[model samples]
Target: MIKTTRIPKLYVYQKVIIVFAALIIPVYFVNLLMNMKGQSFIKQEFSDSIQSKAQFYSNQLDDQISFIRNQQLQVVNDSDLQKLNFLSGTLDVFEEIQLVNRVKERLSTIQNSSDYLLNTGVYMKSFGRTISTQSGINKLPNQEYEIIGKLYSNSNKSSIYYQGGRLFFIEAANNSSVIVYLELSVKKLEKTLDQLVGNYGYSGAFITNEDFSYYISSKHDDSIVRKIQDNVSVEQSNKNDDSHILKFGDQSYRITYNHISTLGLSLYSYMNQNELTGSLKTFNIWLLVMSLVSVVIIIVFSFSVKLMIHNPLKELIAAFRTLETDNLDILIRPKNDIEFGYLYRSFDKMIDKLRQSIRQNYEQKMALQHSELKQLQSQIKPHFLYNGFFNIYMMCKAKDYETVATLAQKLGSYYQFVTRSGADEVPFDMEYRHAMDYVEIQRIRFSNRIHVVAGEIPDACKHLMVPRLILQPIIENTFEHAFENERKGGNIHITVTYEKKSLYICVEDDGNKLTDERLQALQKKLANCSIVLEKTGIINVCRRIQLEYGKPSGVFVSRSEHGGLKAEVIIHFNYGGGSDV
Candidate 1:
């Protein structure tokens, strides 16, 4: 026995519930899309907010630096400042002192203009004199003069440069060999750094020179400054003031930087990313909770729909599957709404009518087929009996006792087989025995003028039950027509073979009496489905076999290999022990 894999069965209700569950997936997909889009927007807005702070601090520093440079420009053009630098080595002490006092007053007015300006002074290289404000009319130390001395060598126009760990503005007085220097207040710049970071936790801001050689930060922690120095690059910050997110240690920070062109430095600020986007996290948590609740509600509602709708339709679908197995006895009760109840009752009534119609149809067909067999069998008996009696009478007139006795014996045995008390269908062995008896009687009647080539049925095919007398009429027709008008060289060949699931009873002769055209006409007649005919011949035998075995079992008539008609009665049957009864 071959084992078959059985598929797991799902009812209509369960499948519908699965479809309902599938509908919930897009809601989750939409939530994912929302979070993705929301995160991008939050990061962009946070970057913009921090960038604005960076720009705000940068503008303030630029404005203050510009004003100080403008004041230095004003002081460089003053007459007292000019004469003091040009003729300092030639002046009397009292006269030089008064002129220096007047220049000191002008410098004092410029220094007091901004809170971030710590000091302002001018150094004259031609007179070897340093002028006052912080230290009036004194020759300063060489280290202090190194910045003004070396910075003025490469600059004449008012320009800003970073040097000696401080920011300065240097400008040379035209043709006067005088240089001015201004220093920014470190403590006040630190205050600006504090405002740049605002109120953000885990945040800081810094100012670094273009060379990255020195820096000032809101928190003067050296480790963090070094960490920022090691991990971050501030090179492109001078080109544009864009914001970035950077990770340092275990924390992520949103960093913003801008180049201060006036000061020749870049300003950097940072805040923790979590602190910047904390509100978005809260919004996502609430959204997830709400979406989960909606999913649960959908699942509960789908089960309820299964109970009200899918359950009713599930029964209808089950009834149809049962019908596929030819089981029409399934009962569906009217326990649902009127629409479903009406359908259930209709199915019940339809099954009852279907069963009744099948019963009537089957009985009528069986009775009619049995009657057709009996009538065909009866029709064969009378015509063959008349021929047998006529041949015996002619032999009696000729007084051929031996041949008549043999023919009579075969004729009697043929009748006994036709009159056998059993079903109209009999085994192949019995049918073959009956056909041989008829062939023997005809052999004796034709004597030396004819020869019959034949053999017994194969042992494998001896037990297939077939319609009675299916072979006799074909042989009888071969004799009555093929051997008519005394055609010589008469030979008859009968063969029984089994192939596939069918038995072939072929009776061929060499009489040459039937033309190819006549054989064609007979083949078409034999294949015709209308089998009820008033003749006991080749067509009749074909009809009986078709009625018994249905499709693929019929008489096929063709020109035989021996140049005569070949009548083949093919019957299909199943192979089993003792054949199909």
Candidate 2:
């Protein structure tokens, strides 16, 4: 051999299988436990939802059956059936039978008679005639004949009892001697079972009489129905529970039996274990796939941990150094080896984390700046107070004693209302008064150049809660911006309306034309402001609304039809009363 080099057999022969098994075993068990828990939750939820729907449908069916029975009894109590029964003349027997047949056909034609999960029929004891919607007119067999006679004997009360493989019912109206027999249909009952199975994903079955001779099944074998019938009888004999789950072989089934006292028939619901767990099937498949993937990922992760952890730290440090120098464009892609592949992933994760941290810091800074701006804007209220004082000073200097006295009283009351506030929310009546006072002060300053016309606040909404000073600011803005250029005949209209769920206040002015540029600028300024101009008196009402009620509840501004600006503020009533702006 040329240079005779031997490869190390230890590396190739190492027990990787043992290492993989040790890692995967615990993971598989954990996955199984999680799957079982999740499946149980889904199955319980599905069962509850379906159970509610089934009970609803069952109640509807019972109502429909009761309605049809009532209608049939009413027909017996009517004139037609009585006339057919109580004829006194010497009548041909065959002709009388033909007349009875016509009457029976007419009653069968009633709408919804076929919809009942039972066969409806009329049995006449007088003519020995039994007219069934299912079997047509025929002479009743001796046994049915005897049963019908017994029913007619006890006709004072409506009778419901079972015989043969069917439920039988007879009701005789006091006005007529006609006897009606209603037979429950097995096929219709089976259809109801199918509907329940389709809706709830559970199989069901029913049996009639104590012997369990007549039976219906829903996807289960006839033997299972028979076995359940036997068990139900034994339980009833022992006076035990009527519902229980039976496991036969690998399958499990839940059986619930109810003895319908009116018809003497046993109604039941059968549920399969697999059907109950049907919703869990998809989750189990996904759990299995994830378990397999987890094992492979763990192996790869363990192999590259040491190398991957070190290189990424180095690259991240270099990137951070560049970032310190304000170079945000540094790339940190690792090599293509297994260890470096993991390193690249770690670097990508670090970059995402850093980006998130930076975004969070920026948001916090913006919030702080916004808070400061709001504090500054709230100082505008004091400026308005000072302006009111200035008006009072001028009134006194003019030597008009009556005017000065009246203005001073109004100013005192306005300041009292503004400064004496404890809670931010006030009654609509009080808020309205505050707005009127502000407008009155503005009227004194502007004289007859500005006129404020406010509509009557409804007594129903008077007690409704509203933010303090909500309407005053909009009124102030109308006078300050809208009527600033108007010489005379400027009108400000304020209307309050109460809707079903919300209160609306509309303030419109007929002063100056609101230009598109001003509207755009106002929108931009309101958007940038920390507190909404709509929430605060002049500068921050919109921002306060955004903070308090969020974006959906805020101030909206537009040009009124009167060729001036309109400011609309919407306040929604909350549980603690009206929400803060």
Candidate 3:
């Protein structure tokens, strides 16, 4: 009787429910996560829209500043203004007044055409005179002169600079002949900025000079501007795009900043986050309802699968459990469900047929067991007889009478031992003699090139039973494969020994053919007997011995002491204390 390992029992319905739970639990969590993630994505899109609006406002302000800078450049680069050379002192007072009037006319033309500029003027330090777009006598206030004088010393050909909270566009003549200034109105730009972003969400835009003196925007609160400035420094410097987020007074604002390099001004816009993601609560409620409905559907699907698949499978498995215990009398009744009805009927018919075939199968197994030895004998006998007869024919053709007679007699004795029909086991001495006959025949064929040596077997182990022809194929394998052209001294030695009720028969050769790796591989193959044993005659012999002695007995190969192949057989048996069994 064989003890079988028990399988952990599980019901089909329980397994199906377990699989459903495994699938549904992850889907439930994933659905909830997708709901949350979808809401987050919606919020992100809304925030991105706000940022886009902020960017739009920044671009509008940049355009306005660019327009103003272009106007200033046109006035600064006026060809008429460039031609006025004030260095010549030869002009009289009338000529000087004429020069100043001509400059004023050009300034008035510039100021009238530009909508953003409040006034355009030039202050001449070389003559200590100030000229404006106005047509009066060219006199200016002392306080105004003081401010313009300060601007004259520090201004360049760039955009308008702000000083004392007032906008001024100042440009010096190429020859330092005059410093041009355009005083811009902050109030007007503030109104324009309001109009630009007034229709958008809680949004405001501003333009500021680098010195923080002059600024124009819809709102004047410094906190929001400071937040924008602080966050923009980190975000805009690392990223080329001009959008960022700022938190001020428990409110979040998406701020965008754009730098107009031509005018040296920074444009900024701010928008509130609350206005962007306001409808998220409604979306979340809808997501919750959808998630609940999905869970209900999953529960219903799990129960439906249990009724449709699990119950029928459970009944089929219960019927098949009888086969596990060698009880084929059990039958599977046909199911009412069409899916399993045919399967159940077929299974019942199979069990009935299996019961009727049991006795016939037992008789067939007995016949197979009786034929296995005959098959083994048949596999080796014909091939061996053909080779033996061919060798005798060669000896006779060579007219070697002594060798022919000796080989013919040995061949007859070898076949007689191999063809013995009833017994599969032979005594150690008979097996050795059968192996020696084959080896001696080969020795005669090879003549002086081969040497064969047989050691004395122990008397106590002589009659111990071993599988037939086990040793002869091993000895024959050496002559067939192990010898090479380089090996002039081909030596074969057979030895038998006994220890602790186990017999070891080793056949070795000095052909120097078995390398260490080859020896290890052959030994491993013999040890792992799961392979097909029909490849070599020696392997078939090894598998036969293992099968006879309940798998603890088999042939093994190793490196010989003479630096060649060594084949070994380890067989375990009970000895009657110094007596042959």
Candidate 4:
């Protein structure tokens, strides 16, 4: 009896669920992580875009400030200012007036060319006289006079100042104790800021100095600016600013600041977090919907598997279960699904084939038993047993005790080998000894009329298991058929050798009983396997070899160098065993 180990098993529906979860869970997590990464990327891109635009606006403001400075330079280098030189007493009243008119007209031209300029004027510090494009020859108050002079003395060549919502560039006139000023408006600055903040709903303020006093701003709620004022630390305001995100109240803001160093002003933009991540939120929603839809699809697929595969396979398994009771009379019902229908049909057909094979095996067993009985009956004839005893008795009467004992021992071994019903295969040495015994008995019977020669059988080959009586039948054929006419000088030679992963057993006889046609017919019969079982004697041995080691290791017949028949039995070392029955 054999014992088999049991293995853990998963049902079809369980496997389906496991496989679906295995595939879906990873995809869900991967999609979630990808969405998170995408949101981060979007935020970074928005940050970079806003910073770049803010820098652009800062550069534009710098250029405008540079334009005002250049205008001041033009005024200081004016030839009319050099010719007038308010302190010079060389000019008459009319000439001095004309000089001042020339300077005002030039200043008018310089102010009119720039879109952002509000006013341009020249103020004389030595005489307390002011000439302007906006106001005509106004004398400053004693207090204003001291302030303006101080402002002029302290100004390092040129400087910008913001007073009462007005931006100005002031410079000293060349070669004269005079001050020149140009005031700028906010129209162009507002338009540029609108362009930058239009796409996203971002609002900001422009601060001229570090103080949160007076500033220019777009139309935004006052609370937002107040929130920024309350939250922006002194360190954050004064430092070389980098873009950042901030949380104020219940809302989040992306805060960025760009500073124009020349004007001592900074532009601060505040973007709502919701607006910046709106698209990414939409993407996350879409991904979530797809995940839900995937789960629904998996559920539907699992249900389909239960209907189409699991149920049908269950029926097939139940049908196979009947086989445990040695029942082959199972009728598997057909399925509506085409694949399962075909499977059910094939399974039914296989069962039918198994039943037919079982019946045929029973009949073959009966036939084999009948054939074995007939063979035993033929082998154990009264004449063979009586002749063997009589020969022994004569040997004993002639006082040949040793020869008699040897003959009796050979006879016992031959009968013992022939009568074996348990094993189909025996070791090569045992078969070799049995064949030698048969040959010895033949030699005793034929006397000097026949001879037997067996070549050296290597020790390595003596242990190989070959079919019992595989060799004896060939030697028996030589006496029965080969030397049927004459026995004198009859020769039998045997050789065994191994080569090319196969063992070859050769038996040759010197008796020339077969003609060319008969030898050819015998060779053809040995090679043809369809009629192998119909053959007797040597052909039967050839068939047994074919059955044992397959066709490549079957017997071959040829004309021997001894001028007679040679039968070679080929057996492979790798041939598997066969049933004795």
Predicted model with the maximum TM-score: 4
Off by over 4 Å in 3: 1-10, 24-79, 82-168, 172-200, 209-214, 218-245, 256-265, 274-294, 318-337, 359-581
Worst 10-residue stretch by lDDT in candidate 1?
572-581
Per-prediction TM-score: 0.44, 0.41, 0.44, 0.54
Question: How does residue 96 of candidate 2 score in lDDT?
Answer: 73
Best-to-worst order by lDDT is 1, 4, 3, 2
Over 508-534, each residue of candidate 1 has an lDDT whose tens digit, in order, gives 988866877787777777778454355
Task: Report the C-alpha lDDT of model 3 over 323-383, residue by residue, as the tens digit.
Answer: 8899887877774758788789878877775676575564563354345556656766465
Q: Judged by lDDT relative to the true structure, which candidate is superior, 1 or 3? A: 1
Across residues 1-581, which tens digit of lDDT does each residue of candidate 4 receive?
89999987989887988888899999888988898898998898988988888888788778877776777887887878766764446678898888888988888888887777877777765545777776666767543334445555664454866555656777775454767877677656666666777666545545435566756665444677777677668536556656776777777887777778767776777788888887777887899798999889888988888988898889888888887688887888684659989889878887886787577764664455345333532454466567678888988899989888888998898788877666667788888989898888766655547778887698777777777777887888787687656846688899999765578889998877767898898888887954655645676676666655667777788899888898888887554333222
- What's the lDDT for residue 208 in model 3? 76
Q: What is the C-alpha lDDT of each candidate?
A: 0.76, 0.65, 0.71, 0.74
Q: What is the lDDT of residue 253 in candidate 2?
A: 77
Off by over 4 Å in 2: 1-34, 90-102, 109-112, 117-120, 125-167, 172-177, 199-202, 207-213, 217-220, 230-244, 256-264, 278-289, 309-581
Candidate 2 on 273-358: residue-level lDDT in tens? 78788667888788879877877876675555434554455566677788788665656676666665665665567567567758
Error of 2 at 299 (Å): 3.4
> How badly does each model clash, as a count of residue pairs?
0, 15, 0, 0
Among these predictions, the greatest lDDT belongs to 1
